[model samples]
Target: MVLRIHFTAEDLLGTRFADGPAPLLELELAVAMRRRRDPDPAFARRHRSLAAPAARAIAPLNELVPATGAGPFFLDPLSAGLEDGLELVRRATRTAVRGELDRICRNGLPVTPLLRGLAHEDRQAWQQLERSLRAAHTALVDPVWPQLRAGFDTDLAWRGQVQREQGLRGMLAGLYPGSRWLGSTLEIAVAKQVEVRLEGGGVLLLPSAQWTGEPLCGPLPDGSLLLLYPALTPLPHLYLAERAPAPGADPDEPVAALLGRTRSAVLRLTLREPTTGQLARELGISPASASEHARALRRAGLVTTARAGRAVRHSCTPLGHRLIAAAGTPARQA
Candidate 1:
């Protein structure tokens, strides 16, 4: 089956990629994927690793989002970050919470204690749900977050490159698995048939590291549709524990030697497409130092720096991607 997204001219103009992956959405999808049996060996291995604490960390979430059917959209609030999203969930009104839970239950999902308490606006239930989300994120997301961020950056860079070279339609056609850009409409492959009219509401495209299934289409808080799919840039190392660096060997030594450790580190971080301040914070350096390093890379044609509003964003150039790839880095796909 396919999901047809009809678009207007304004919708076409407004459609764009999100700034980065949505942490809350990714967390929910990761939890959902972890519960199922996947064919990938890496996912299987990772699933097995979480088999012990997985139930306690993720069981309550099933009430909010059962094994099937739509869950409460409030769970994946469109916010600045995970904590902010969780706060939104915490602050969801009683009516909204009850309405969504009632809707889910109507779909045949059982009324668990969490769901019942949430439906009744119970404070303790909210706290328990929030704790489960935090614990699940710490277990499943924190370990691979940096790598996921890097991979997302690589995919965003690629999408930008595609749009530059192939126009909006071309980029949209290859945006996700089985996506077809058919003039006024974009079609996406899914298990069920559905149609969405983007009557100037546009759309937000988000890539996922954990969701290996078909594309997911849902509404954002702002009424814009969100299309979530597996990230295009492959970072197999994130899923494979054996891919870790061997004992006592510095995997980055070659790149560090070539570009010097600090500069090389800066180059690698550019894959996350961070701003000067973000780079500074991540590298524990002053903004001045980060700017200098970025400037050096830009001068060497290994990085591209762009000014967005007041912030200067740094991204890897194709040459920079090749150099990082040669160094066997997790980010930067060539």
Candidate 2:
């Protein structure tokens, strides 16, 4: 079924994309996907690795969001926002928690015993909820966060360009095939039939790497939208680690001649845009030495660097991407 989202003048003005993914929301979605017996092998591997802790981590949350579907009754309070630190969860308020729980019960949805007690503002329930979120982060997200954050950063850059040149109407129309802009109305393909009249309330479009396909759409208390959509295209390389060079790119010829072996290795490692510190640790090079090479490559226009959050990140430019793909012959013996 299609969810028809009607936008008012104010909503059109207020509608904007989210800055990035919400870790907690992503976790919730991941757990939901697991429950449904996800078919994709890539997602299956990631889910299997979390099997031990994930079940325990997801027990409480499963009440809030089932594997196959979610009702709006409890979704909003669980947003936990986009705070990279998971601060929204740490500061989860009892008042807000109580209201959402009350609403869920009123809506006649099933709730776990733990969720029942939480409506009474039980400290134990709150603490357990907090711990589950944190544990899930450590077990499921921490190992992959650097790559996740990098994906988010890159996706935002692409979206910014799309919105700036084409405008909101254009962005909505071009976002993905599952969604289309029908004049003032925006229709999203979803299993549930929902028609929301967004009276100029803001719409937060979140691009998630975790939710493999389709999109999740909901409304917030503030009358804003929470649209979480999987990336339309396979994001650069979400499930795969970027290789430094083509498998047979010779390490001793062509471009390698210009940068020397050590420096050559540095340039190729940047295909994934690792931070200066990360790159150094990976290559066993000193930070100072890595920085020097980064600067040299930046000057040569073969690579570029940007400050992403606390890390000064480096990435190969298109020129560099092409150069590396065409470089190196293979290990040549003496």
TM-score for all models, in order of appearance: 0.69, 0.62
**Which digits, one per residue and each the tens of the lDDT, describe model 1 over residues 191-215?**
7799999868898988765666667
Relative to the true structure, candidate 1 has a C-alpha RMSD (angstroms) of: 13.2
* Per-prediction backbone clash count: 0, 6
What tens digits encode model 2's per-residue C-alpha lDDT throughout 137-250? 666666666555555664465556456756778666545554778888988777768788776677888876555555667766687887776553222234353434323335
Off by over 4 Å in 2: 51-54, 68-109, 164-166, 233-236, 243-334
What lDDT score goes with residue 77 in model 2?
A: 37
Off by over 4 Å in 1: 67-70, 234-236, 239-334
Model 1: number of backbone collisions: 0
Best by TM-score: 1
